[model samples]
Target: MTKPDQIKNRYNRVARCYDWMESPMETAKFSKWRRELTRQVTGNTLEVGIGTGKNIPYYPEEVKLTAIDFSKNMLKRAKLKYQDDPRKISFIEMDAQDMIFEDNTFDTVVTSCVFCSVPDPVKGLQEIRRVLKPGGQLLMLEHVRSKQKFLGRLMDWFNFVPLNIWGANINRQTIDNLKKAGFTKMEVNNLWRDIVKLIKVRNIK
Candidate 1:
């Protein structure tokens, strides 16, 4: 199978248990980060890799939210969380690397621990840049490779387990990947000693 297919398959297999598997971090840290990121977005917002709809409850009522996931099973789980909500929210199955949205379509885009699982991070990021209006921003709460040599090497060494089990790379150089994807105006703040980060990148086109 292709890389994208492999990722999709893996996440599909894990969708049933995805939220449970992430509960530890979700409770201790990610929940807070998700709230901080989701609550701040405005206008037409797109959420890439909206796995199990973890951020759904945190979104403000006013934003017209569109959440996308590549895995059908994952999207199914997400829909359950959002089904009864009265807000303007839509869910679609879409690959981040090749979104169906028109150019300059969104005012803000949000992601939570998503880039690590994207098969082609730069391509996915570029697609985000493509859909974002000029002056629009991408808000991300991601875990990336540490800059510290020892910790970085450790994450690299054990990257395969999560890559196979979760379809996520634990050592992604996301900041550099952002630069390569044409997001030059950025603010990166460490949330967990350089491993987890809260990033804001403006689409300066």
Candidate 2:
């Protein structure tokens, strides 16, 4: 099976039950953080991972939205989240590693706690760069491994086991991945002592 299909199959198994039993406190905090991170965006936006459509309501007025997710089941949940909204958004089932769009098509690329789960975060980030117009920004809200030495070490030790079963890595350093993806103008500020970060990156190329 294709990678996207594998992702879909994996998340589909957990879709119906994920939102309810998932980390409530983490979800709430991430939701609040996404609001702050995305407040800087303007123009056409593509929200990668658009999981469960959790950030759909928080999208600013006047911005055109195109939400993409790898899993059909996740998009279904997100559709329910915006059932009554006056805003219209295009939801597409596409892999973040490769988007079916021309280069320089989008003005902004938004990711809310999505990098950790990508099978190849670097390749996915490169795709974000590929579709984003020059000087456009990539707005990200991510939970990263702690900057503190011992805590980071512990996260590294525990990440592999859970990533196999849970499909997300707790210790992924997304900021580093963005840099590797050729992002240069980056402003990263921690929300909760290095655990959560709001990163705004521009393609300086």
Candidate 3:
């Protein structure tokens, strides 16, 4: 199977229990991060990985929203959870590396804990850049490789465990990847000891 297919299968297997598995972290940190990230979205918005609809309750009601995930099962759960949300949301199954939207389509793009699992993170981000209008914003809440030499090396050494078991990498240098994907201006807020970051990017082109 292709890498995206592998990721899809892995997520599908865990979809039914995924929300429950993440509840602990969600309650402690992710919930607050989601609210902080979602509330800043404006105009036509695209959420790249709307897993289990966790951000559904936090989004502003006036913005037009479209949410996508490659795993059908995960999207199904998300749709069920927030079907009654006041804002009308379009839910679609799409691969981040190859979105179907036209160029410069979205006013803002958002992600949460997503790029760690993308088979080619730069390619996925390039696609995001392509779909965003010039000067559009990209908001992300992600856990990335530590900058501390010791912890960074430690994460690299054990990165294979999460890659093999969960199809996610724990050692991605995501800020660098964003630069590689053509995002220029950015504000990065360290949320948890340099491990988790809330990144706001201004798409230059």
Candidate 4:
């Protein structure tokens, strides 16, 4: 299988248990960050890697939303969870690196804890930039390689195990990758010790 396919399969295999594994973190910390990041979203929105629909409940009711995930199993679970919500959300199974969307299509793009697993992070971000209208905002809640030397090295050492077991890398330089993807006006708020960041950027195309 290709690398992306491998990653997709990994997520599919874990879809049923994904939320359980994340329960502790989500309850204590991630849920707050997800809420804070999603509440800022407005206009027609696209959420990439909308895993398990964790951010769905937090989005404002007025915003029109479309969400996608690479794993069909994951999207299936997400759809079930949000099936009865009042606000409409379209969920699709799609690869982040090659989204089937027109250029300059969305007014806002958002993601939560996603980029770490994308096989080609820059390529995925480039696709996000492509579908985003000029002046559209990209909001992200992501964990990256730590800035502190010892902790960063520790995360680097631990990353390989998760990459093999769950298809997630704990040592990605996501902020740098976003810049490389061509987003110029950006603001980053360190949510937790410089590892988890709330990043907002604009597509200036």
Candidate 5:
């Protein structure tokens, strides 16, 4: 199977247990981070990798929300999770590296724990930049490789496990990939000892 197919299959298999695996820790550790990052989302907002629609409840009601996931099974579960919500969130199956939207289509793009799983992080970020309007903002909540030598080495060692099981990497340099994708101005806050971060980048065209 191709790389994308492998990713999709792995996520499909894990779709049912995805939220369960993270809920205990995420509820305690990431609730504040999710609220802080998502509160700034406004206007035409696109959330890439809207796994199980966990971010849906946090987003403000006024924003026009469009969410996409590469895994069809993931999108299916997200739709079920948000079906009763009054906010009309459009969910689509889309590859972040090659989105179908026209250029300058979104005013803001948000991602949470997404870049680590993208097969080509820079290419996916470039697509994000392409779809976002000039001066638009990119908000992200991600866990990346630790900067500390010993901890970073530990993450590198364990990275292969997640990659093999879920096609997710634990040691991606997502902030650097953002720079490589042409996001010049960024405000980064270390959320948890530099392993998890809240990053805000603006598209200055």
Candidate 6:
């Protein structure tokens, strides 16, 4: 809890303001990728960093969903979104670095635009891999360091200040992290030359 304070503070402060802060076109485009990824989520699905539960409604009604976030305010706002359909969502206050769920309990692990912000991406990816069942997917929609070297360098330079202020590192190499975890089946679709990334990893059973 204390460890994720910066992450908590930023999102908590923006929980109510996020929709306004986020660009409509950017949000809509990202949602399309998430919707496509959701189609592969069968049986039990664990969604990490599910800020305000934005992806909740997009998932098929038949899917069993469990969502977690460290920010209390973020979860509070998300609860309001699901107030009418509470049974469809089980909200938990937890961290992605160490999920409380049993190993192999989830058939699909969903992460949307979260990897770039995690404090320790390798550990986070490891945790996601740990909870998934055999043949399960680690579906990710992330904003990573851009493929454009110049833009990526700029992001790296500015990444430190935001990391201190909000616990988000905008310059993570998430593609490498998945590989380090022994997840070899990689399908990465880029949006705008690497500003946004959609990665799906089929972990070994």
TM-score of each: 0.98, 0.91, 0.97, 0.97, 0.97, 0.90
Question: What lDDT tens digits, residue by residue, belong to model 5 across residues 1-205?
Answer: 1287788799999998988888897778888889999999989999999989888889999999999999988899999989778888899999999999999999999999999899889999999999999999999999999989999999999988998788889999998999999999999999899889999999998
Task: Give per-residue CA lDDT, model 4, range 78-112, as digits (tens).
Answer: 99999888887999999899999999999999998
**Among all windows of ten consecutive residues in candidate 4, which has the lowest summed lDDT?**
1-10
TM-score of 6: 0.90
Clash pairs, model 6 backbone: none
Count of residue pairs whose backbone atoms collide, per candidate:
0, 0, 0, 0, 0, 0
Model 5 whole-model lDDT (C-alpha atoms) = 0.92
Specify the poorest-scoring 10-residue window by lDDT in model 3. Answer: 1-10
Model 2: per-residue lDDT, tens digit, 1-205? Answer: 1254555577777778777756686476766776787788789999999888777767888888899988888888888878666768888988898899899999999998788888888999999999999999999988899989999999999987656654677998888898898887899898889888888888776
Reference-based lDDT, each prediction: 0.92, 0.83, 0.92, 0.92, 0.92, 0.80
Residue 40 error, candidate 6, Å: 2.5
Which portions of model 1 miss their true places by more than 4 Å? none
Clashing pairs in 5: none
lDDT of 4 at 186: 92
Candidate 2 regions with alpha-carbon error over 4 angstroms: 1-7, 26-28
Of the candidates shown, which would achieve the greatest TM-score relative to the real structure?
1
